[model samples]
Target: MSSSFERYQKRRLISSYFSVVLSIALVLFLLGLLGLLVLNAKKVSDHFKEQVVLTIYLKDTAKEVEVKQMEKSLAMADYVKSIEYVSKEQAAESMKAENGEDFMEFLGFNPLLNSIDVHIKADYVTEEQLKLIADETTSKSFVDEVRYDNDLVTLMNNNVKKISFWILVISGLFTVIAVLLINSSIRLSVYSKRFTIKTMQMVGATKKFIRRPFVWKSVRLGIIGAVVALIGMAVVLYYIDKTFPELEFLKNQILIASLFLGVFAMGIVITWISTFIATQRFLNLKTDQLYY
Candidate 1:
């Protein structure tokens, strides 16, 4: 009977440790997910901006050589992300497909002008920057007209700012919630050892001496939990990258390393603080309060 009771107690201890580690890992996983969203926000914004293109139409008398030279010059611009040349034939083909009409056949000749589709960098997607770019492109002798949807560009910029602000707010709230959850989890885990802490204090043990082992234990558990959380995050990231190869652009080695370190540090700091406070409470409590 004595041996069986001892084995049961040992099992309970193991279960307690397992419970604390898993709880911490779960909280950390949530925090890591939020961090990933915040970090990838810029990449998402850039992807949308790259979809906006500025069209520069060429004059009817513009030679192919002159168009190519203009395209080369536009490609060299600092704000240009990419540029594609669309010949008159390609534009007509696209329009015919869209409208289901052979307009060139009806008109005897292709009325569409050759144009360059220029995608500006996200940083230069603003209306003022686009106007400046259009002005510069229109000044070229071979260019007949430069066009973009000014209202659409302004609307997209405004929406991006609003979306970014909301995302930041949500991320901040989640971080605070995670900290509180971690704190409560650590406190409960330390609470289970309150009796032992009280007995040590009654035996003339200094507060610092009583705290050393509990603090170290918490630190070790925190490290284990953090490492497990990071492993889970890596697995999630791997599948995400595999499914959406474009997302690979958002993964920076340095940034990922820093994120993992941030999680690890947070785990250690929260566990230490929570354990210290809980242990201090037990140390100062009257023996009668231990029952509560």
Candidate 2:
């Protein structure tokens, strides 16, 4: 009977340990996911921002040399990421390919004006920056007009801001939830050992002495759980990189290392603090109250 009772206690201990580690690991995984989202949000925003194209239409009288010079000058602009000059002939060819109709041949002359397509940098996609670009381009002698989709630019900027706000709110909420969950799990695991804590107290053991072993145990669990969570996060990131190769640009080695360190620190700190607080509560409880 004694041997059976010992086996029962051993099984209970193992179960508690497993429960605590699993709970902590799950929480850490969620936190890591939130971190990755926050890290990549800006890169995604920039990609969309840079897609806004500004079309600069050149005058019919503008010579090729003048247009080329303007293109060279615009290439040096701080706001411009890239510029592609579309000659009237190239524009006519593109339109012909689009509809299988040779409008230039029917008209006897290409009516399409030469134009430069400017891809602005993400930092210069704002309304004011674009207005300045338009005004400057329009002032040039060879430029007939500057055109872009104002509605699309406005929509993209607004959507980016909204997405960033929601991401922040979600990340904050998950962090709080993770802390509460990990704390509760550690508390329940410690509750199972309440009798041991009380027995040690009755034997005149110091609180520090009683807590030392449990603290070390919690620390070990924290490290193990963190390692597991980090592995899970790495696997997820690997899958994401494979599916969306463009997202790889956002994944810097230093940034990922920092994220891993953050998870490790969170695991260790949350587990240790939760275990300490839970142990204190049980240590203060009287033998009669232990039942409750």
lDDT of each: 0.88, 0.90
- Count of clashing residue pairs in every prediction: 0, 0
Question: Which pairs of residues clash in candidate 1, taking residues 3 or more apart in a chain or in different chains?
Answer: none
Tens-digit lDDT track of model 1 for 147-175: 99999899998998998999899989988
**What is the clash count of model 2?**
0
lDDT of candidate model 2 versus the reference: 0.90
RMSD of every prediction: 2.4, 2.6
Candidate 2 per-residue lDDT over residues 94-154, each given as its tens digit: 9999999998777898888989999999999998899999998899898899999888888
Estimated TM-score per prediction? 0.88, 0.88
